[model samples]
Target: MMGPTHALSAGVAFLAVATPMSHYVHHLTPATAAVGTVVAAGAGILPDFDHRQATPARAFGPLSAALAWTIGKLAGGHRHGTHSIIGTGVFVALAAAATLNPWALAATLWLCMGLAVRALWKHPPNRPNGKLDYRDVAGLIHAAIAAYIAYQLVHSGLDMGVVPWAVAVGYLVHLIGDSMTEMGVNWLWPHPRRYRIASIDTGKTVEKRVVVPALYVGLAATVYLTYPKWGPVLLHTLQPTTG
Candidate 1:
């Protein structure tokens, strides 16, 4: 699958997870949700570091390329090591260590902010010509919301334990994505055999053109169907509490 597909899939998976931050760290503002969504998406594809040419690896730049080389060497190449149970466990444990620690929340805050900043960078909060444009206004609004999210996460001193689980879920989503391919992933590593119920050729026209779209559409439909149950939760989480 392509980078966009993996990202969108992971984002959808994140939406399916709950965040304790809603009650402890921060309210479930759109900004916080957006940050969480991006984190989950990145984690979803993080296991692909073994494939240097893989979308996630390329997006991370040269440093990631080197890491991919090392991972590839250790795992005996892509879709072997990181695609297995051991890899998933390692990722989850590491992520939990980072996300569940009180002090580590600062790094997580910075990470989320960076993601939000990069997204709004193209919108430019100010124009060189001195005239304000929709982009500038939009950028300011985005920055403000993200800043608020970062503040809550940083000062609340709450253990954002849910974040790591959400990321792990995203990784599982990636495994599921790989499972639907002809070159099935060895999900249960050390056990051998790439297990898959159905196989679709990865990077082929069918996958990019047909399968990806279908998955997204299905995701959208699921969201729509489930919105009724989640809508009230969002309202309560985001709405200001009354004294």
Candidate 2:
């Protein structure tokens, strides 16, 4: 699956289960649900840190590029160690540990937001003769959004304990998405055996035309179901006022 598709899938998955699971999971709150949704969307693209040219790699100019390069090398190339079940557990552990320190958690949230925005937000079309590519403009906008969300998340009084679960679910969702593609992921990495159920081509007709669109629909439906009051709020905001 491609970056946007992966993001949408994870976001949908998170929202779909967040409400029902909230009953058993004491840390969940409205604020946490909203924040976790975004974080999960970003985490969906985290495994692709093994690909130097992937969206997360280029999201933050040279800093992220360097980080991606380093992770890619350490993970032994794309879809290897980082795409495995062990990799997912490692990410969850790291996320859990990061929550112990406020600064580390803030940085992690910021990076996740940046990755999600890079994948999910629509960029302007490139100009044929312009000196500045609009894609750069979009990048600046995404960075601003990421920074704002990160700041809000750091300050929001919501419980931070559920974040590691969000990270874990998002990472697993990404692996599952890849498992549906023709190039399946190795669930147990070092063993070299891959598990697959479907053969959808990444970014091709099935993905671009079918899978992504369906995921978008699923996201919308899940969001509606998760946030029932949002519909009334949206309607109230959109309703015209008369003196």
Candidate 3:
């Protein structure tokens, strides 16, 4: 799926779950909801940064690849290392330390970790080119991480409002959207080994078709869910707001 598509799906998923959650918790102010939603969306994209070696990253410049390579090297190269549970935990720890928000950090970390484990366990050594399917593994790891983050945001006590629910929804949508593509996600990765769904490859025509519409629809949903009248008005009035 395209970057926009992925982002939209994740964003939409976050909003969907976050919104309802906000209502349920009733403790999360509008600002908290917004922050949580944004964090969830960001987490969704965190894993794909591994594509720096591919053409997608080339558009930016060699620096993009270099950065990705450096990060990959640190984590465990392509898929086996940083893209794993251990790596996700490290990232969560770092995020927590940096932000000083244990709940948010933990949530994001959990999202990525879950997905990575699932992906790693599901697609067992079916490399097409005899080389490690680094890209595949990386994608799955990231997806799992993204899903976990979304889940955390929705359930976190920060907000029991609609925003949290929206975040969760958007994240799930993102995962499912990715699954629809030829690069199917190992939704049941660890348990259901060698499982895959029939779909278009990433960056393919069919994949684009599915992704584009999904993006627009998700964005629309986010708008509706975040609307002041329909959703929560957290963005505007929260004490000790984040900059």
- The candidate that wins on TM-score is 2
TM-score of each: 0.65, 0.84, 0.51
lDDT of each: 0.63, 0.80, 0.48
Q: Backbone clashes in each candidate structure, one number apiece? A: 0, 0, 48
- Model 2 weakest 10-residue run by lDDT: 122-131
Clashes of 2: 0
What overall lDDT, based on C-alpha atoms, would model 1 receive against the true structure?
Answer: 0.63
Give the least accurate 10-residue stretch of model 1, judged by summed lDDT. Answer: 118-127
Candidate 2 lDDT over 1-243, as tens digits, reads 678898989988888878666778645766677778888999999999998767787676556667888999988899999999999988899999989988778878988878888787645432233244555556566667777777677777668877788898789999998998888999998889988979777556777888889998998777767567445655675689978
On lDDT, the stronger of 1 and 2 is 2
Candidate 1 stretches greater than 4 Å from native: 17-35, 100-159, 228-243
User: Global lDDT for candidate 2?
Assistant: 0.80
| Candidate 1 residue lDDT tens string, 97-188 | 87655456555444434332332233332234334456445544554565566567767644455566556767788888889878888988
Q: Would you list the rank order by lDDT, best first?
A: 2, 1, 3
Model 3 scores a TM of: 0.51
Q: Cα lDDT of model 3 overall?
A: 0.48
